[model samples]
Each structure stands twice: as C-alpha cells, then as structure tokens.
Target: MYQEITHSFTSKKSLLRTIQNDNIVYYWFSLLFLNKSLRATLSQNKNTALSYKEFIASLYFRFILVFFLALFASAMLFHVFSDIYWAVLLPVIALYLSAQKKGFKAFCNIFEEFINQNFDSDSLQKKTLYQIGEFYGDRYAIHSLVDTLQRNIKTYTYFFGISFVFLVFIYPINTLVTCLGLLTTVLIIRIYFNTFSLLRHLQNNK
Candidate 1:
C-alpha cells in the first residue's frame, strides 16, 4: 500500500509538471505570434507616421525578436530533440521557417518606407529649421530628446527584467555573457549612428 501511494504521488507530480510546461509553451507562443501579427500589421501600414526614433525602435525590436526566435527554433531542433521527436518537430520547423521568411520581408518593406520618409532630402529639407522653430518654438528638440530617452528607458527596463528572470531561473553564466554582448551591441550601434549623423551633417553643409 505504501508503494502504491508513492507511485501515485509520483505520477501526479509528473502530470502536474507536464501541465505547467504546456502552459508555459502556450504562453510563449501566444506572445510571440501576437507580436509578429502586430508587427505585420504595422509594416503594412505605409502611411503610418513614425519619428526617426520610433522607426529605429521598431527595427531594433523586430531584429531582436527574430534573432531570438530563430535561436530558440534552432536549439529545439538540434539540442532538445531525439530522433523520434523529429517527426513531431517537422511541422513546427516548417511553420517557423515560413513565418521567419515572411517576417524578414515585412521588416525590409517597413525599413524601406522609413528610409524613403526620412532620407529624401527634398521632402526632409522642405521642413526647414525656421519652419520647425516657427511651428514648435524652441521646445521641439527638447521634446524629441525627452521622448527618445523615455523610450530607451522603457526598452532597457524590459530587456533587463526579462534577462534577470531568465538568469535567475535558468542561465546564470549565460546572463553575464548576454550582458556583455548587449553592451557591445549598444556601443557598436552608437558608433554607427554617430558616424551616420556626422555624414548627414557634412552633406547638409554642402
């Protein structure tokens, strides 16, 4: 009777664990796919007026999201599966690949739109500094800077919070690596943007 009770308890625990894992998987997929759908919708809206910072933020988010998604799918394919599980993963892999390809194309389209909107010298120059000053007085640049800062803070908070949770629960060593990688990425991006800005400034002077 003791053995029977112990066996029953173990089975119950296993079932609960399976249910919890399923819930987690469901939640993750829902969130990922929902974001993908929303991004797709936004990408289709070519008339959407986004500031330069917002455009950059959208591109950054999409790039990071796609990178992690692809990484997760690859890990599942190569590390998490046994030979027998390949059959189960085949459909998922196909779906993921298809979605990834479509997502990248959508991202490109949105990026192209942003470039056309922001880089067209004729249209951009039409809104001259004098016109901007008349319209927004002296506060335009300050407002833009404040908005960008707030957005950056929110992005940092979200990224750090998620990273912290994963670090504490799953990968403490990887968290350090991720932080270093993130810092490197930020520095590289900053340098790229600074260079781009310098080039634009020179062009405007000419």
Candidate 2:
C-alpha cells in the first residue's frame, strides 16, 4: 500500500511538470510568432528566407542563457544575504527588466534599419496603406483569420501571464513583483486589443 501510494504521487508530480513545461513552450512559441520584429527578421534575407525554426531556437537560446545567469546571481545573493526577500525579489525584477530591454533594443534596431533602407518614405507609407486597405477589403475572409490570430494571442498571453502570477504567490518574496508583473501583463493585453481596434477603425473609414 505504501509503495503504491508513493508511485502514484511521483507519477502525478511528473505529469504536472510535463504540463507546465508544455505550456511554457506554447507561450514562448506564440510570443515569437506574434512579434512583428521577429517575423520581420525571418523575412530579412530575400535570397533565402531564414528558417523559422532556427530563428526561434537562436532567440530561445539567448533567453535561456540570460535566465540561467540571473538564477546564478540570485543564488549568490541568497548565499551572501541569508534573506529570501532581497535575494529573490531583486533578481526576479532584474530578469524581467533585462528581458524587456533586450527585446525592445532588437525591435528598435531592426525598425531603424528598415526605415533607413527604405529611403522613399512617402512611397513606403503609401504602399503600406494600400496593403492595409486590401487586407480589410470585403473580397475575402481575411478578417476571420485576423480575429483568430488575435484571439490566440490573447489566450496565450493570459495563460502564461496568469501562470507566472500564480507562481509569484508560491514564493513569499514576490509580492511587489507579482503586482507589477500583473499590471504589465494587463497593459500588454490592452495594447494588443487597442491595435486591433485601431486597424478596424481604419478599415471602416477607408
């Protein structure tokens, strides 16, 4: 009886870990696919389209490298301070900020290069407008596709964000981080919806 119970507990633990890992992968994949800059990077090479798998792998590798580095730093902090609050909280905030900074930097660099290369700003803007108009035209069911993409984006974002928030509660030192993280997640969701709303408004006016 004792052996059976232990085996059942171990099996359940393994299953939960598998589910968590799978959710993390799904969230990360959705993030890469939804991000405009990452998508643009894939299209950078006209002669040969960059392999999407490789691109995602490269970025994920960078993220994991940084994440582990942060963990090491957190461990060192805990060792020295002997306090969970300062050690864990500081590293957690630093990790979040570092990720945001790196991502934004990449986006800015790519967007700047794209603008500089396209010297004819007027033509570029006109072409973009034309494409947008066509996308929202009634000829096809593109809106359905857009709606589905937006829905999935929101769903994945919430799944990951809420999971993180739940994790924050597990660690007693995560009070401030949890509140701020939750707020940021809400802001991100709002921005995504707002972008879609703006696009639809343009479609209506056009």
Candidate 3:
C-alpha cells in the first residue's frame, strides 16, 4: 500500500511538471511567432491595393488565425512525442526566428516609407520632442497622451474582462496567469517608452 501510494504521487508530480513546462514553451513560442507574423504580413501587404487601415485589419485577423492553428499543431506534437517535444520544436522555432529577422527588416522599411511620405522633418522632430517631454516631466503632454491611451484601454478592457470571467469558469489557473501576464506586459511597455524618451532627449541635447 505504501509503495503504491508513493508511486502514484511521483507520477502525478512528474505529469504536473511536464504540463507546466509545456505551457511555458507554448506561451513564448506563440508570442514570438504571432508578433513576427504580424510584422511580416503588414510589411508585405503595405503597398497592396488595399487601404492602409484595411490592410492592417486584414493582416491582424490573419495573424490571429495562424496563431491558433500553430497552437493546435504544437499541442498535437506535444501529445505525440510525450518526452522529446522540445527537441522537435526547437528546429522549427529556429527556422522561424531566422525568417522573422528578414521580415522584421522589411517591416522597418515599410515604416520608414510611411514616415517619409506622411511627416515632414520639422513636424516629426517636434513630435519626438513632445514624446520626450511627456516621458520626462511634462504634465500637460502626459495628460493628453493618457487621455488618448485611456480611451483605447477601455475597448481592450471590456474584451479582456469578458475573457477573464470565462476563463475563471473553465480554468481559474489560466485566468490568474493571464492577469499577471498582462500586468507584466504593461510594465515592460511603460519601461520601454520611458527609456526611448530619455534616449531621444539625450540625442537632442547633444
């Protein structure tokens, strides 16, 4: 009886560890591939006949579709391999990362083209200065930006709130993880913007 109980406990622990590891891997892989796909599709379709906003929306939907498909594939692969899932996934991920680098460069070119077409040098410079000021200590600019951000946030908040409530019913653990993930993402974005603002300020002063 003692040996049976100990064996069962050990097996459960191992299964739990495997699931945790798989979840972590899936999260990162999905994030990276989705982001790259977004950039790639946008850049590739930038000069297509579609209008800018339409093109963006289409690409956004496509990326979301691809993300779910890839996720399903990964889950299937994980189940099939049982023990060496990462080994199979690593090569595919590497190839994806390499392709994404080229796509990212293309995306950067599209951005440059857009800026060149839409924004004159002085206007662009002033916009940069304003962003820097807001980042540093300009209360007025900060307030203005915050108002704009808040409006956008409200839209996402509704969607996320609904999703969280649903997840709570189906998977409470996922709901908690999702909340923490969102918080971390927000913090990282805040830090990145602040750092970019400081760098711009330094460049202007020099």
Candidate 4:
C-alpha cells in the first residue's frame, strides 16, 4: 500500500511517516522527481514499458529503504537485551535474493499462462486472469507486481525464521515468543508454496 506523493519535495516528518505507513512515495517520488531522464522515460512508457534496468533499480531502491528502516527499528527494540543488530540484516539480504528468484518464477508462470491461452480455448480462470491484467495495464506490469508480492511474502517468512533463531541465541528464556516466531515462519512458508500451487492449478486448467 503506497500513498501518493503530493509534493516534489516533502518534509522529514512526511518522509518518515510515509516509510512507516508503507507508502511507496518515499522512494517513488524520488525517482519521479530527482532523475529527469528516468522520469521522462517513465512518462513515455506509461503503459508499463519499463526497461529491465529500471525495474531492478526501482526494486533495489525500495528494498534498501525498507531494510534500513527495519534495521533501525530492530536495533531500538533489541538494544535493551543484546547488541546483535547485524542479525536483523540477514532477512533483508535474503529478501533481495528471494525476490529475484521468485520474481523470475512468477514472470515465467504469467508468460506460460498467456501462451496457454493462445493455443487453447479460454477457460474461466484464464478469463479472470485477463480481467485482472486490465488493472495492471498489461502482463508486464503484472509480472512486476507479482514479483514484488512474492518477494515480500518470502521476506516475511525469512524474518520470522531469523527472529526465532536470533531470539533463541540471545534471549532463550522467552520460550513463548520463540515458539510463536517458529510457528509464524512455518505458516508463511506453507502459504508461499500454496501460491505457486494455485498458479500451477490455473495453468493446468487451461
């Protein structure tokens, strides 16, 4: 969920709020206003004709912004007990890796679905996907969006998994919190796999 930017130059309070609120305006506005060439290209490519370099740059920018914020918050919260702030970055690094991996898979799945539709008749699921594509401008945009989502979900699983291990190493006295983190990590992993399973089911149906 991203809040739209209202000004070319936003105040510090607004910037911090935007980050805390998960508002993309934090970095999106920077790309739109700071880089004239990229802005012009993006304006011309309104139909989601973003270049590969642009896509990677945008993803990294957003990821880096969130990573620092998470790192700061984790440090503040954990400073009372331990000084293992570096451990917070493990999940962030894993998130970048997983995003690239899952994002490619999602793009392939989406492309396969499009190809399947061409050779075979339109099924209910394919039609629904096409309709969903309308909101995303096209399949390319959908690929970007799906990739973002998959990476976020995977990162959450990574976060909980890391949290469980870190807590055990630093503050093993809190068994309840550690167990909850473990359960959350497992649950999210299951859901992540289910997303791919659903994609496969849709493709097979067609």
Candidate 5:
C-alpha cells in the first residue's frame, strides 16, 4: 500500500510538471505568432508613412529600451543590485576579452587613436565611430548571449514562479505577486510572438 501511494504521488507530480511545460510551449507559440504579425503589419504599405529602414530601426531601439526597462524594474523590485551590476560587468569583460579576438581590438583602437591625434574635424562621426561600432558590436555579445539568458530567466520568472505561487497559497501577499508576475509574463510573451511572426515572414520571403 505504501509503494502504491508513492507511485500515485509521483504520477501526480509528473502531471503537474507536464502542465507547467505545456504552459511554456504555449508562451513560445504566442511569441512566434505575434512577431510574424508585426512584420506583416509594418510591411503592408506600398509607400509606408515611415521608411521601412526607419521602421526597422525604430522597432529595434524601442524593443531594446523596453527590455532594459523590464530588467531595471525586476532588479529594483527584488532589490537585486548585484543582478543589475551584470550590465556593467558585461561591457568591461567584453572589452578585455576583445583583445584576444585576432586584431579586432586593434582595428577598434583606431577610434581612440584618432581622438588622441586630436584631428581638426568638427564632426565626431568623421571615421573612428564606424570602427568603434564594428569592433564594439561583438565586444559584449549581449545579442548572442540573450537566447540562453532569456531561456533561463523566462523559465525562472514564469514556470518556477507560478509553481511557487500555487504552492504558497497559504501566503497572502503571494496572491498579488503571482497575479502580477503571470500577467507580465503573458504580455511579454505576446509581444515577443508578434515580432517573431514578422521575422518568420521575412525568412519565408527570403
């Protein structure tokens, strides 16, 4: 009887885990669909009100800022100062590691060298900025790291948090936190899907 009870308990636990994973899959599906839709909506105009280039650029900047703000808010709410400090560490480490990347750093150094040379060009964008952008692009590699970090953070933020909420029904404040956290995750997932759908369309066209 004890063994049977243990078996049943394990089975129930497995079911809950499956449900949680299903929730995550649904979230990704939402992201994929939404991204595609945005692509279509923006590209619909034969002569768009805004240039396509500007549209893309605007989306990029806006999403980046939104991501930054979300990160900021999470850290602030949790009082996780060290967590936010990753922003600083990322850049410094990227710069130091950049030195080993086969002259990429040297190419980038032209920017600093130019500033040191004190050229009489009135415009700052004269030339060094281009080299800087190129070298610095890979310096921190935030873009490359995002997929992994996002996977971990999203799971922790959504699935684990939800699980904890269900388990913590005894706590009063959990009701509020759980609701807010779940709602935020849902919204973010929806936005991600909208853009993802657009990306799919672009890929299909190519």
Candidate 6:
C-alpha cells in the first residue's frame, strides 16, 4: 500500500514541469529589464497594435527570447544583488499570473458579449474582431507567462552567481573557478544562439 501511494505521488508530478520550473529560475535571473518594460508597455498600451487579438495571439511568444537576452546582458553589466531576492521573486510571479488570468477573463467576456450582440458571421469585420478577441486572450496569457519567466530568469542568474561566488570564499574555490570557465564556454554558445533566435524572430515579424 505504501509503495503504491509513493508511486502514485511521483506519477502525479510531471518531470517536464520540473524541468520547465528549473528553466524558469534561469530565465528569471537573466531578464529583468525586458520583464519590467514589456509588462509596463502592455499596461500603457490600452489601444496599441498589440492590443489587437489576432496580432497578439500570433506573435505573443516572439519577444520572450529578446526579453531574456535583454535580461542576461543587463545582469552581466548591472550585477544583480542578493538583497530582497525572495521578496522580489515571488511577488513578481504571483502578480503576473493574477494579471494575466484577469486580462484573459476580461477579453473572453468582451468577446462573448460582442458575439451575442451581433450574431453576424457574414460581416468580416465582426467575424475578424471576434476571432481577434479570442486570439488576443490566448496571446495575452502566453505573453504574461513569458514575462514572468523573463523576470525569474534574471533572478535565477543573479542568485546562482552569488551562490557560486560565495562558495569561492568558503572552500577550495579553485574547482569552482575552473568549472566557471568551462561553463562560460557553454554559456557563450547558448547566449549567442539565444540572441540570434531573438533577432531572427523580430525580423520575421517585421
């Protein structure tokens, strides 16, 4: 019975989710500026092109890599501190999730209302608008999640750097130093690819 319960518990938890969650930490540590700016822009742009459902739904994910890269470079140059790290991290993710859910709910409500008011599929504008609304709802949630990840990536990188650096003073730090060098080579390639992907996506959109 105990063995069955244990297996059940483990089976309930997804390894993919665990990996993605781990990745979120890395992304948060890497992308602070993009997180802040993009979230803010979304708020300020109540009537922007991105507000359109189809446009956002189709392109919500195109900017996350850019945001991540922005965060990474910002961290390398600005140097993220350990102070208030936990306080900052949890609230950001929570707030983003709440905001995203609320926005999507509102969009869905509006779309439904419009459809009820004019059950006219023949009108391309009405049909497109409703479709756009549905798309926007999807894209909004995705964009919001990406923003949360972007912020978390920076936070993760900062924390990781601090933890790794701290180990240097406490023990035979030579090993860490060597490891960091090797990791740097790997990170260089990863970062380069990330940048290229962002540029390519952006250019494609343009």
lDDT of 1 by residue, 11-104 (tens): 2224234323432222221222124333454435655323222443433444444455455657677775454455655655465455434543
- Which stretches of model 2 miss by more than 4 angstroms? 1-82, 115-119, 127-149, 153-206
Error of 1 at 60 (Å): 20
| Candidate 1 lDDT trough over 10 residues, lowest sum | 1-10
Report the C-alpha lDDT of model 2 over 1-206, residue by residue, as the tens digit.
11211222122224234323433322322343334543554456542133444433334544454455456657766675445545566665576456544543443333334334433444444443223223323333334323344465667576666757575755545668777766766655543332333333334433
lDDT of 5 by residue, 182-201 (tens): 67666555445433433454
Report the Cα RMSD per candidate.
23.0, 18.7, 19.4, 15.3, 23.3, 14.7
- Model 5 misplacement above 4 A: 1-46, 49-51, 73-172, 196-206
**Candidate 2 TM-score versus the reference:** 0.34
Model 3 segments more than 4 A misplaced: 1-78, 81-84, 126-155, 174-206
**Could you tell me the lDDT of residue 152 within candidate 5?**
39
Clashes of 2: 0
lDDT of residue 144 for candidate 6: 37
Q: State the lDDT of candidate 4 residue by residue for 132-165, as single tens digits.
A: 3243334233233334344655666577768776
Over the stretch 1-206, how does candidate 6's per-residue lDDT look in tens digits? 11211211121123223323443322221222123334354335444323434223322332443344446556656666435444455655455445444433433333334333434333423333223323433543333334444454565466556555665554435786757754764454344323343334444434
The reply for model 1, stretches above 4 Å from the true place, is: 1-94, 110-149, 152-155, 158-206
Model 3 TM: 0.34
